[model samples]
Target chain A: MIKIKLLFAIFALATAFASSAAADMAIIVNPNNAVTKVSSDEVKRLYMGKTKSLDDGTRLIPIDYVDGSAIKQEFYDKVVGKPLDRIKVYWSRLTFSGHGRPPETLSDSARIKAWVAGNSDAIGYIDTTLLDGSVRAVLIVK
Target chain B: MSRWRLPLLLSTALVGGGATAAELKWDGFFTSTYSITNTKSTYRDIVHDDGSFDDSRFGLHVVSDIHPLWRLEAQLFAAGYEDNYATRLDWGFASFHLSERLNLKFGKLKYPNNLVSEYYDVGLAYPWIRPPHEYYSLEEPSASITYESFSGASAIINRRSGDWDLVAQPFFGEVELAESDANISKFIGIKLSASNDLTELQASVAQGRINAEGHELDDQTKRIASLGMHTEWGSLVNYLEYAVTTFSDSEEARTKAGYITLGYHFGHTMPHITYAGFDQESGWGQQSVTVGVKQMLNPSTALKLEMQRITPQLNPEAGAEMASGLFMDVPEKTRVNAFSIAIDVVF
Candidate 1:
């Protein structure tokens, strides 16, 4: 009985790791754009509104997932150098001061993908599993 | 010959072509501040003499992107000063971007003598209830040492390492004094700033020379130097800055002073304490200490309560005479403790 219980525990742990691996996020852009790879610095500056245009002078429109979403946390942690809580406060100040506006928030990855595919100048990130051929993954945020 | 008219028309035509090709964008900010103070003596108070919102202000910052590499920006600031409305053009300039790391600026700057000087006018950008007067204090009542804040050319360069961010700037300009009789021409100066996230630590140093033309005696030449630092811990932010100023004529007349501020955030409220001091006739010297609490209603608005003690410890004679100098309006051997409450907002 003890041996059987041990095997079951191992199986559960393996499955959990697999689920975590399956949720990796990918940064996506419209397929029509010619640019491919983007440095982590560039991505952070774009999302933070520090840089108004891309390297090619193409106007950039960054989109965000729903607040507190796992993908949102992953992107901010790996790229933006700020946590969700700090970002919310930063956005509040910016919005209230009328200096700038936060990126549009989508309900889920499916909607984010759909919108990015439609807007040529738009950029967003979504789970790799939720991605289809409609939009191209420009760079993986890791 | 219409040679002058031809160039004028050609310039207009070129401008028209560019306007049609690029899109014009607009951006700005609106902000307000209120504060209240308490004093032991009602006769010598310097804070809110009336009630809350004693020093309320509003500003509009406008920017227009003309091209990928050029832009124009301006700011209009207004506040209630001396029981009435006072307004001024705070900042106006045009910038040309040579590259990502290098850019040239020609216009009026807020005398980038300190890191906080640029955004000191934007109250909402900082967590503190109010900007410490120690750093923002003016040498003259009209904010003119020379007719403008600092109108000239400036260059900024930055480089970031793993955990270090470095910024450097050099500028030259002239400031107009209150009388406008003498324009203080600022000599060349270089400022270096560096910060790190591990401690949110920032430090800066500046050195400059100023020359003002006066007919009575020799030109009053002055050398100015300052050092500043800011750091953050969990919910607390601390800042301290010291500046030393001396004149060419008086070797013993140099003055030195500094201020310290400690602020802690409690979700919605932040209580802070500040201490400012300087030596008198050091050409420029004063001492003041303020303690305050700020409650941020939201990201846009806040309320504050502050108390300050103003004393002239260096120049006993000037203190006695109420010399009417910058920050030396009170009599010597006397300290003014004031209490005040204020409300601030940005939109």
Candidate 2:
């Protein structure tokens, strides 16, 4: 009976660690903005520069985290559904062709959240653990 | 002012004064390649028995957003194509956002002929060190209707339907072909494309009057049509394009070119193969097979190695005069092999 109890405790600990490791990401905008919800496809399109405006005709300024950030990689992998290398190539094509530009990158998630909170037209993604009333979460990326 | 002086001054001024009233962004790309072919004759003026670095090039792109409705963009480029790397203005344009779905651009614009025409010089954007010559070479003897850029205006229209984003571009322009002393006037074209997350389909049609000096192509009406598709299925990627050009009065100049490329990704490395063909109505033709691999060193840099085998088609009964195929100064029918190594980077 003691062996089974110990095994159960170990399994519970592993589950807790896994859940924390796979933390959720939140797509955030200024709390004053009218938008309350956004689809994954819309976020993808906005971040990719395929669309420049929101559904209600508000021009959007998408922001990104700096290169080599672990959260940046996770956001692209989970939300954008494209490998980071492919995204780089796609932006290269657009930038060189004068078609579009990628989002300007900030240093960290705190700055991204702060920027989103300050600008009504800005949108950014951050770890859900960093969420607060300063910004509104439009989409929760799993 | 010299050709290089204006863009340099403009760039300096813009960058220096970028702190106020406008959002300025700067980006650049570079490619350096060494290529050699097993032949005495030069192919594309760069590849021959003696290796050359003439394929290397660099470009700097700048974009200034002055307002919600106005933007300015320019690209300064330098290349080693027999000119000793002279800097020049590749394209400079102003874009006007008229509405949520429409934009107008005026200036020097990249030729909108094929799928890769706009970003062809940026090797990091594609899997090949060089795009297949059979379809991408503008100086190919059989079909030389395309130009690098035109001075004019273009409009972009956008729409969305279900999961696809649709774009339509209509443009009119005039261009001078420096290589052959040709002038294209009254040029008009339209390109339509639909794309989603994993696929894109494109079609375009262009018409122009061509006048080449001291050549048989004088005073000809040229019409070109092309179809292209680029798709990715998980780790598998495919690109296919077919184009045809018809000269109103020169039957022998009617040409068709096509290529299909298949590539599979293995982590950070991809190996690709392509089969390309170019043919004229008078039975002059060439076909090539290219095999290459691209390795991503990082997010913004790539290294590529490629080998190609080109076979020239000669038809004496069809009254074809030259067996040079795409190579220069070849007198007899023969196959040529080429090898190239390149590094591409963007920042």
Candidate 3:
């Protein structure tokens, strides 16, 4: 009975660690904004800076994590179907040609939430565990 | 020191309290290439050299969103093709958004054609040290029309449906190039591209009137068409392009060029192979095979090493001169080797 209990304990710990490693990401927008949910394609377009407005003509601002971050890599690899470097290369082609810029980057989740909460047009992402009353969740990436 | 201090103070004051502010974004890129070849003539953007940095170029770009619906952009570009650091305004444009899907731009726009034409100068975006010269070369006896820049008004249409995105642009512009004495008084072209998650397809058609005074035909018009496809699956990338240009004089004088490339990415390294060719009726005919490797230093920097074997295949039966194949001074049916290393960076 003691051995079985220890095995269960180890299994629980491993599950917890796995959950922590693969974080659940949530896309956040300003609470006052009318946007509630966005499809994956809409998110890709916004992040690529293809368009600045939402479906209802509300100007939307997309935020990004700084380079070489774990969550940023996960977001790009999982949601955008591209490596972070490849995405940067795409941006380089546009940015150097004076076409467009990537989204504004923030340092951490706290700062991101603060920025999103203050600006109605802004959007960002954070770990679902960091969810609070300040920003509204728009899309959840499982 | 005073000037720096004043500007710093003003920027701080503007961001701190000012209400009306322009959001400015600045970017820069540089590419330095050194190539060694046995030939004594120029090919594509590079010239005949033992080892020349003449292909090196530096650019600084500034984009300002002065208003939500209006934006201005400019690029200060410096390069030395044959001379020393010559600076020019590469592109400057202002765009006004009519709706979420359409916008109108006015200025000097990058001449758009195939998948890599507009971004051909941006080396870090592609897997090659340089795009295949026989297919993408702007100058000379390679093929037919040259897709460079012009002053124009452009309408850009952007649409997104499901997992695909489409961008179509049509423009009416005036193109003038005095170097080759090929003057284009009026130029009109349209380009349409669709991109899915990992695939992109593009097609373009252009019509132009040559402002010729002593050439083949004065005020004669010609047609150019191009089709391209690019796709990436996992580590493998494929690029294919085919173009044909029809002159006003005769259908036999029409030029054609095409190329295909396959590349595989492994970690920070990507190795690619390409085969391209160009045929012109006036005697110049060339084909090349290029093998290259690109090493990514980081997200914004890369090191590229490439080697190409180019053969100038001129048809003697057509009564063509060796000088028409201007890529090199080598004997006809001989292959010239080009080995190049380039470093590309973005900041």
Candidate 4:
């Protein structure tokens, strides 16, 4: 009986950690956004400023939480095909020439959620647990 | 002293008030490079001799969104491209987006002359610390050098369909040439560019004439076409470009040039091979081949090594009193083999 009880506790703890790790990342878009889904590749292009519009020609404006955020790094590795250093150099080259600007940066997930919720054209990443009726969750990054 | 005082005062105020004041966001970059070659040329003295950071640079940039549709930006760059100390204005522009497909820009613009012209201006932006100096030769090549930077208005248009993307741009501007008031008359040019997941192609044509001291030298015309392909299998990037130019004067002169490069990446290191040739109306032509290697130590840093064999060709003159003038008093042929090492960094 004790062995079974201990096994149950261990399983519960592992499940909790897994859930928290997945919930730590949430792909967010404005409430009015009609897009229901996004592929990992598309998300990468959008955040990198490579593609300016969605499939339906809806203009996209991307935002970021901060430079070194875990979600940001995850998004880059999954989509951007480059590490932080390469992204920095890429942005440095583009921004210095006035060709493009890096995405707007917020302090934390709360601010990211708030910005995406208020702007109809904005998209960002946030903690899934913090999402509510104010915004729409489009995708979940594993 | 006065310029330094302002920063000092601002820091004092921030410390005394203990106010975060919106948490100033910062972004910037810095780079250093070194080059070496055995080409017996005067321009060699101006570039890196070996593995040393002679042509170094550092820059800072910042931008703030004043509104949803508007933003303000500025950048300052300091480099040793020509000498030990020289600061220049890289870009200061105001852009007003008219629509999703169209936008208007007014300010100092980096003119699109060649494939790598804009990024090559900054050392750290490319795998090579110094662009092929023989091709992007700074001073002696009057036409290619002056077209690197300009001031004027530009329009950019882009459209995408499936896995294919298309972009087109046409601009009109006059470039600053030398200290003289010699301004290139209005130039109208257009570029057609297309890209898929693995391959990309671009072609451009521009025409204009130069007016120096009210002396019309000739009507200047330029056309360049290039194709680039990158495949996923080996992470290979290969490109080739051809440029033809014609100048009108009391006598008409034409020049033609082309370059091809194939690069493959192996984890962090990429090795490439290059072949290029160019010809001038002055009976001067050159052909060379190079083998090079580049490594990305990190995202913001890279190192490169290259060795090349260059041969300058001299054509024979008509009605000359020499035998096979092509192999005349030019010691039959002048061959130069050069090796170079470079480092690039961004912060």
Q: Rate the local accuracy (lDDT) of all candidates.
A: 0.59, 0.84, 0.77, 0.61
lDDT of 2 by residue, B1-347 (tens): 34566476656656665545576789999999999888776786777678999999999999988676878888988888837788778887789999868999997888775788888889999999988887888653322256457779999999999889899999999886644567899989999999988899999988888878676667788888889999988889999999898888888878899999999999889999999998988776789999999999988999999999889666433344433567665633388888999999999
RMSD of 2: 2.7
lDDT (10s digit) by residue, model 2, range A72-130: 88888888887788889999999999999999999999899999999998999988889
Q: Which runs of model 2 end up more than 4 angstroms from their true locations?
A: A1-22, B1-20, B140-144, B179-181, B314-323, B331-333
What is the CAPRI rating of model 3's predicted complex? Answer: medium
TM-score of each: 0.72, 0.93, 0.88, 0.75
Which residue pairs in candidate 4 collide?
A: B29-B347
In model 2, state the lDDT of residue B272. Answer: 98
Compare the candidates by TM-score and give the number of the best one.
2
Worst 10 residues of 1 chain B by lDDT: B139-148
TM-score of 1: 0.72
Residue ranges of candidate 3 with Cα displaced over 4 Å: A1-22, A54-58, B1-20, B39-41, B140-144, B178-182, B212-218, B250-252, B315-328, B331-333
List where candidate 1 sits over 4 angstroms from the true fold: A1-26, A32-42, A49-122, A125-130, A138-142, B1-17, B20-31, B34-48, B51-54, B140-148, B177-179, B198-218, B251-253, B281-286, B312-328, B331-333
Alpha-carbon error at A138 in model 4, in Å? 0.7
Q: Candidate 3 vs. truth: CA RMSD?
A: 5.1
Candidate 2 contains a number of clashing pairs equal to 0
- Best-to-worst order by DockQ is 2, 3, 4, 1
Candidate with top DockQ is: 2
